[model samples]
Target: MPEKSYPMTAEGKEKLEAELKNLKVVKRPEVIERIKVARSYGDLSENSEYDAAKDEQSHLEDRINVVEEMLKYAQVVDATSIDPDEVAVGKTVTYTEVGETDSETYTIVGSDESDPLNGKISNDSPIAQAILGKKKGQKVTIATPGGKFDAIIDKVED
Candidate 1:
């Protein structure tokens, strides 16, 4: 089996690298110091502080591993190299629902950078998946848990 590639924009890759750096250079050292302090409290079996610190260490290590793996398989999608007429990862698309009066925009990104509130959506999301590879002005049907709606692609920007 091949490792799954994560498609992300250059900005997304930079953000991930920054987070990883913070985890390794800052969070790791801070957690180590916490563990050391907890150990000095003595009795490991009954020390809640020690237990909590150890648990936190476990979770932190898990998160570090996940981030490392994601970075290792990242495939950077350069927006400038893509066709402005096509919708793809790293492109911001504007569309209007069939019955909606207003148009909305969203930037399709990797799962790691998905922030719906900020208009960044994961490529794996239902709406993104439905519109990927579509051309501007094309009509696409998006199926979500709520219902299905038609989206008319208005614009695609690199």
Candidate 2:
């Protein structure tokens, strides 16, 4: 089977790289030091600190591995290359509900950088999927797990 591609914006790639560097240079040493301190606590069998440190090390290593893999397959997307009037990854889209007066805006981003609370949504998300490739002023119906709704594209900024 082929490896899955991880699409992301340049900013997202930078964030991932920074995280990976920190993990290897800073967190790794901290964990090692923690293990050494835990070892000095005597019996490993009865030392809770030692067990906790080992568990933390395991989780940290797992995270580092995942980040490394993601970086290896990352495909940085350039928003400027895409049409400014179209909705696509790395573009911020503003839309209004078909029957509502209020408007909402969200930036379409890769899964690794998606933060719905901050208005960044994953391309795989129902709303993003439905609106991707659509032009500004186009209307789209998005069917999410919560329900379905219609939205009119008001703007698309790269």
Candidate 3:
């Protein structure tokens, strides 16, 4: 079986690479130093500090592995190669729900770069999935976990 590819924008891939570098060069050494200090404090059986450092090290290593894997299989999507008027990964899409006066805008990105609070949503998300490949003035029915809603694509921008 083939490994799953991580679809991401070039910017998103860069962010992941930066995170991986920080984890390896900075965080890994910090955790190691903490573990060393904790070990010098004597009895490991009752040492809370030692246990905490070990746990942190475990989490950090897990994160590093995940990031490395993501980067290894990354499939960068270029917004410039896509149609400016169409909704796709790396494109900013604006839409208004039917019967709602307010409009919401979101930049569709990969799962690793999804930050809904910052208006960046994963392309796999219901809203993005509903709008992908769609153009302005197109009506789409978005089926979300909460429920389904009708929305009209207002704009698509790079």
Off by over 4 Å in 2: none
lDDT tens digits, residues 14-83, model 3?
Answer: 9999999999999999999999999999999999999999999999999999999999899999988988
lDDT by residue for model 2 over 1-158, one digit each (tens)? 98888888999999999999999999999999999999998999999999999999999999999999999999898989988898988999999989999999999999989999999999899999999999999999989999999999999999
**How do the residues 19-91 of candidate 1 rate in per-residue lDDT, one tens digit apiece?**
8999889988988999999999998989998888888889889989988999999999887787789999999
Which has the greatest lDDT?
3
| Ten-residue stretch with the least lDDT total in model 3 | 79-88
Order of candidate numbers by lDDT, starting with the best: 3, 2, 1
Of the two candidates 2 and 3, the one with more favorable TM-score, higher being better, is 2
lDDT agreement of model 3 with the native: 0.95
Off by over 4 Å in 3: none
Runs in model 1 deviating more than 4 A are none
Error of 3 at 138 (Å): 1.3
- lDDT-superior candidate, 1 or 3: 3
* Alpha-carbon deviation at 59 in model 1, angstroms: 1.1
